[model samples]
Each structure stands twice: as structure tokens, then as C-alpha cells.
Target: MDRWAWANGLLDMAETLVIQQRGVRLYDGDDKTKFDSGTLLLTTHRLLWRNQKTSDCCISLPLWQIVFFEEQAAGIGKSAKIIIHLQVAAPNKESGPYQSSKYSFIKLSFREHGQIEFYRRLAEELSQKRWERISVPQPVPAGRSQPGRVKAVGIVGIERKLAEKRKETDKNISEAFEDLSKLMNKAKEMVDLSKSIANKIKEKQGDISEDETIRFKSYLLSMGIADPVTRETHGSGTHYHMQLAKQLVTMLHAPLEEQGGMMALTEVYCLTNRARGMELLSPEDLVNACKMFEALKLPMRLRVFDSGVMVVQLQSHNEDEMIASALETVSERGFLSSEEYAKLVGISVLLAKERLLLAEKFGHLCRDDSVESLRFYPNLFLTQD
Candidate 1:
């Protein structure tokens, strides 16, 4: 069992584990208060550091409270320390000039053996938790003002341009001019434009610092399935698998776009499981669910290569387009390797090999196998020098 399972055993309430590392010690980052030994756990919603000796003294940090993290290298017999910066919100009724910004910090130490991995995983979980907290809506307390929602700063310019164009046309004619469908389409366009601006901002900010890159990754991961169908909700039956398959297909749109419209089944499994959280489905279950896609007439299909490597691709994904592109890539060189094809195709080398084999099966390409390496070329090139 994982350290997270051990930690969950200690908890009285149910929680979803994100990441966990053992043999951790905590200290107050501000005063360097007396150290406490424990195991560190990151859950879907909070950071937990539990004292191995005393259960009552465990410390919890919510995602909304985190601001940043800093690390310090360690010497012999000492583990590396991670200083987590947090901005705890002050009570609304207790406002005064004397009240500080509510900044706090905590330090955690772990063995030097895999300190880098520990740090990376912690940062990843922290970033993802923060984004999830931001993206998901939360209930407001009674009599408290709701927090302001995020809006694309570029939307103002877009609205201004639309208004100017509207003024140039007939201004007197105004009676819900657009039908419901047209209005919905216009709203979708505005939403797409806003998303584009947000992505551009994220890209620019990510280039500024390594911290921003981590933050960007977290934001991307937080775009998970908001309403994942599970055995509990949909029951264990064909109907459940059918619903799960449909949801999976819908959720795959963004990932498919990122991977150039095709993705390895292994990658799909990992992403789906991560999105499922504590209600993770087994690999067999996922495969079975995917198998129903064809029967359900979803836009995606599961294809198994001769090598037994499986992939999920859009029904509209054209093999001829892929073959044409691959041929173009190797036209001048007259040869291509899986590595080169992978970079061109935005897939793993193993999956690229399968693609090459598929093209060869279609008689679009020919392969040259040697003791040193294997290469592929357009089938027509076989007759040339």
C-alpha cells in the first residue's frame, strides 16, 4: 500500500489522496519553531502533515491559502526543506489597521535520496489544488459578499469593437434581432475569444519564470471532468458503461486537440484515472467502456494496431492526411525514423512505430530493417536509387 493509504487509515473522514511521501518532518518557517516528525500527504483539497507519534497535532493547509513555495538544500544526515508560503484570509468582522496581511509559512523536510522528485510532486499537487479551488464554485457564507469571478481583460475591447460596428449599422432597429440559436452561437464566439485571450496570457506569463510553468501545468490539470459518471452514480451495468463511454468521449476533446487528434490508450488511461479521483476505474474497466464507443456511435473510435498498441482517435481522423504528411516530411531525406515521426505526429515513438506500420500495411510506405536501425520511406521511393 502507498503512504497515502497509510495516512488515509489515520483520517476519520474520507478523502482523496493526491500524493504522499514518508519520513517527513515539519517546522515553523517564521520562528523556526521546534520540529515535529511526520509523514506528508497531499489530498485533493488540502496538504496534510501528520505526526507519527501524536495524531492530534497534525497540520493541514488548504489550497486557497497557498501563495508560493521555496526550497533549501540539505547537508549530511539532514533532509532538504520546503518552505510553503500561505496567505490565510483574516476574519471579515475583525478588520483593523493593526491586523497583518495574515501571511504564514511552514517548512517540511524529506530524505535526500529522492528530494527532487518529492519537491516536484509536491509543487505539482499544490498547483493543481490551487487551480481546482479556483475553478470550482463554492457556496458563499450568509451576509458575506461573493468573491469576484475571473474575466478576460480582452473582453472589454471585444465588446467595444462590437458596439462600434453596431453603431455603424442600423441603431434604431432593436427588438431581440437575433434568434435564440444565433444568440447562443454569438455567445459561444465570445466565450472562445475569451478563452483564447486567457491562454495567451498564461503562455506569456509561463515564459517569465519556472514558477509560472508549474502554475500553468496545474491550471491545465484542473480542467478535469466536473461530473464524472461512476459505478455509484450510474450503477454497474451496460447502461453505466455506455454513459461512461459517452462522458469519456466528451472529455477527450481537449486532450485530442493537444495530441494532434490521436492519443495512445495508455495515456488515455492515466488521464481518465487522474480525472476520476478516488473513484478510479480499472484498466479493464476503462477498455471495456471505450469498446462501447463504436456501438454508441460516438465521434471517437478505439483502434488496435498489429503490434497490439491501442489508441483512441476521432472517426474523422484521416489516415490519408497522416500518410501525406509523413511522406512530405521524408520527401527530401527519403527516410524517417520513429523518433522523427513522433515529433512530427505529436505522439510517443512506440505509437509512431505503429503508425508507420499502419501506413506500410496500407502500401503507402516501405520499411528497411537493419541490425543498426530501422527506417521508413514512401513506397514509391522503393523503385528509385
Candidate 2:
């Protein structure tokens, strides 16, 4: 808690907002604190929290202070949380809610349920080290000239410097894309350039593009796989698939979390290929790679449903939790068709039906196949007996 600093909620130069969540509570170590029910904002440089009622009361913690973090699943009567372990507080740390803490960590309880996506984005920011890239100008002493430095003093000088930089950037871009061979050779540089362009567009326009398809394509391009495992790179056969499976697990973790911990194999194929850019993966190769997910004991597994719908889901996805949620929804609504439940839950009709079938299999719900469509009701047999 001492690591936090009081702030006026103003972003630093070059800093940008990544994500935000409402109804979040900050925990001082494991104990409760007065900083309850606030909005948590994740930026490139720091994690800012402001009271929902009193917006003026805001505090921030630098991203560089974080050592690591993990998600704590929601439990009975408790909200989900992100446990952020921190390094020792700096000697010159700014004032915060607490002077000292027993534990070297803090928790952010997500009451409104956005921990998964927040965690994913947080991981990305940490891996990127965006804070280190931010070069804040240091104040110089009153009448001192810094050695080996020439500042752009006037408008013409500034314009000349900007023009030179733009010319160099344009030259680099042209050279990188002069031919297909050059583009393939400079793939890593291209990815970095793509991300920079996307970030600039997002900063100015709030998104890379207005069109949905274009926006999605831009997103995929921004998340390019710098070192994708390919047959040519790793050689063919079982060894190649094994390496491919490991890479897929790392690449798909965030996407799976965003998709409610499960995604259809076909959707994964499209996303993977798009992210890979030129190197596309065939359906057969994708299936072969996914089959090794279980054998390798990765965090995700490939499951082929009875209906032949294959999906990749996190191992932490609990069947009991899904069943309980479905049961509670059905109990509240009295009865729900698959389509109705899908609309309510914001999931596909196929997944909704699968959940309903699983609940029925567990005897928590009973299905009624009527003329209109199949509907499910709370299992009265379990309640009556």
C-alpha cells in the first residue's frame, strides 16, 4: 500500500489508457481498506484508482513497481480478484493510504466481473514494458548548459527536425517493403511498425478503423507473432507439432480468456492464421497441434463435443460453476429456451444449448421439447425429493 502515490488523475505525456473497470475495491495486503468501490484505470505507465463517489480522491501505482500478478477466481459470496505482488517500496515513495503493509502485495477485487480481460491486458502491458519506453524530460538547473545537446529553439528548427524524422521513417518503411523477400526478412521490424501505427491511430481516433472487419484485422496485425513455430523452422513430424502446441498455448491464452474460456476450433483457426499474417496454418495441422495440448499438459485443452463441435478451453474452466450458473438463470426465469438463454448470457446458441444439456445431464434442469422449440426448466425432481 505504501507504494501508491496520491495523484490528480492526469495522464503523463505519451501515456494512454489501456482499460478500465468499475466497482473495484483495493485491498491493503489481505486486509480490507477504506479504498472501497472505486474505478480502476489501467494505463501504459500506472494503475490509477479513483473513488466512484468522490472522483477527486485518486491514487496511482507505477507499473514498474509490480513484480508479478495472478488472478484469483471468484468464490462463494466473494468477488474475483487480481493479486499483484510488488517489489519493496522505494525510500522516496509518495504518500498513500497506508504507511506500511504486512504483506508485499495488494489485491484488486473486481466486483463487477472484468478481472479476466483486465488481467490479460495487464500482462500485455507488463511484457511490453511501456513504462520504460516513456522518456520523461528531466529538469535542468537554472543557468547550466548540458553538454553534447542542441535543442530546437524556434518553430522553424522544430519543423525541420520533424521533417527529417518523417523522411527517415518513410525511407525505412519503403526499404522494408521494397519487395516480398525484403518484407519477409524484415518481419519483426514490420510488426513493430504496425503496432506503432495502430497505437497512433487509436490515440487520435479511439480505434484503428471504423469498419469492424478492418478494426479486427488491425488488431490482429498489432498482435503479430514475431516467432511463430513453423514446419520449416522446427522441422516436420511430432517434434514440430509439439513446439507448435506450446506456441499456440501462449498466443491463445488471452483470446480464450476473452471468449469466456472457450473458443470453437474454427474460430481459433481464423484468428491464428490472421495473426500469423503470411504463414497460414491448415485445419489439419491445427487439429494435430491442438491434440498435443493435453499430452503436453498445457493450461488449455482441446475438447470434441458429442455434436462434433471442437473447442479450446482453459483447464481452469469449471463445469460445476457453469452448471450452477445455468441452473440459477433457469430458476430465475422459470423456463428458458436455448435461444433465450443465449441472448441473456451473451453466448452463442450452440454453447447455450451445450450448457443446458450439461445441466440436464447433471439433473439440475429438465428439458421439454415442445412444438416451438426445446426449453429447459429447473429440475423439480431434485427439489421435491
RMSD in Å for all candidates? 19.7, 20.2
Q: Candidate 1 on 1-385: residue-level lDDT in tens?
A: 0011122234322235656665676655444333345667776566777766776555555555667888887777765777777665445522321234323666677641334556677677675453452242344678976557543248795676466547534432453465666899999999999999899887786466788778977987876677788653443457668998999998887788777678999999999988877768788878989899899999998998778889999888888887666777766678888988888767899888877887788777888898857899888855567
Residue 59 lDDT in model 1?
51
User: How many Å off is the CA of 117 in candidate 1?
Assistant: 40
For each candidate, give its TM-score against the true structure. Answer: 0.45, 0.44
Q: How many clashes show up per model?
A: 0, 0
User: Poorest 10 consecutive residues of model 2 by lDDT?
Assistant: 130-139
Best by TM-score: 1
Residue 115 C-alpha lDDT in model 2: 75
Which tens-of-lDDT digit does each residue in 279-323 have in candidate 2? 789899899999999999999999987778888989998879889
Where model 2 places Cα greater than 4 Å from the true spot, the runs are 1-222
Top of the candidates by lDDT: 2
Residue 57, candidate 2: Cα error in Å is 80
lDDT of the candidates, in the order given: 0.68, 0.85
